[model samples]
Target: MGILLLKLVVGLGNPGKEYERTRHNIGFMVVEELARRQGVVFRKMFWFPARQAKCRIGEHEVRLVLPTTYMNRSGKAVWGAMKKWRAEAADTVVIYDDVDLEFGGIRVRAKGSGGSHNGMKSVLEWLQTKAFPRVRVGIGPKPDGADMIGFVLGGFAEEELLKLEKVVERAADAVETIFSVGTERTMNEFNQLQIG
Candidate 1:
């Protein structure tokens, strides 16, 4: 069969109002943007550790998910969603934050390692595969010798905050591109996006 179209889209982040605007929560921001565009709202699901929303993109029925498992153990919810929807690695796309790229930069990879993301580590662990598509929104540099946790959990700077909505909007556009076209094309078009 050809590449399986998107069935599940998961955004990794800690859950709660306080953590909503942190740099690390960009994944949540992007996916929430998608929900906003589609006019769908996320609701806590009983069968999984996630809040889920359903929407249509083209002819595909897509589910947008935010893990309620916080950041580190995000895999539990992603795996749960996959199982619930019978979606394989190829059919699911995981969106998350990355500290290596400069703030506002975005990267799309067809299949790859988890890198230094704790949330992605947990996802890779539970999914038992590296063959899933992922979108990484930059929140980076960590300011030399800074504590990684504090940096990531910190809120964006005032200037950064000003540009955040556009960044999230662009990333959401990238997700729709992934579904409308495919991962490789999305990567080709989005990987070079020079925001931040």
Candidate 2:
């Protein structure tokens, strides 16, 4: 719980105007909220494939990253930032959308396989380990017989959009809590609540 001591917080998503706020970009949304809370703005980093901002959360100075390498190749950006920060796989936290849970659900784990997430798969491949912590924001249930790709890439429905900010805020809060309280305590406090 307390051991995830992270230096980098990466949000996986495809970079482009059209992709903004889409279901898959919820990871981006969470990091953006974290940046806002720290009063920092993300700027293009030529040295790496991402927009980065430096911010202090609790006692730890963490780098918030939004990968510009697109979803599937997110590992490239994350790995680059990890190298820049001299961080290992365990010293990073990955936040991404998961279609397996209902919308508003969030799952935080210390370590696990990438599962069916291509972006996470790429991260695992590049990092050569599955020991990193991750925050999976729910984006799912995919609708009856709908195309998985279309559902994830699509924007939230009008109703869901109403509560989007709150969900993002909750996710960001969970992250800060991880830094402050510890992952286990934070998970115990946050895991069961479904935001409206």
Best by lDDT: 1
Cα TM-score per model: 0.96, 0.95
Q: Candidate 1 lDDT, tens digit per residue, 131-170?
A: 9999999988789898999999999988888889888999
Candidate 2 error regions (>4 Å) = 1-6
Instruction: Show model 1 residue runs off by greater than 4 Å.
Output: 1-6
lDDT of 1 at 116: 89
Clashes of each: 0, 0
TM-score of 1: 0.96
Question: Model 1: how far is 181 from its true place, Å?
Answer: 1.1
Report how far off residue 58 is in candidate 1 (Å): 1.1
* Residue 136 displacement in candidate 2 (angstroms): 0.6
Candidate 2 residues 1-196, lDDT tens each?
2443347999999899999979999999999999998899989999989999998786777999999999999999999999988887776889999999888998888889988999999999988888888899998889999998898899999989998998899998888888887777878888898986
After best superposition, candidate 1 residue 39: deviation in angstroms?
0.4
**Model-by-model lDDT, in order?**
0.91, 0.89
lDDT for predicted candidate 1 compared with the true structure? 0.91
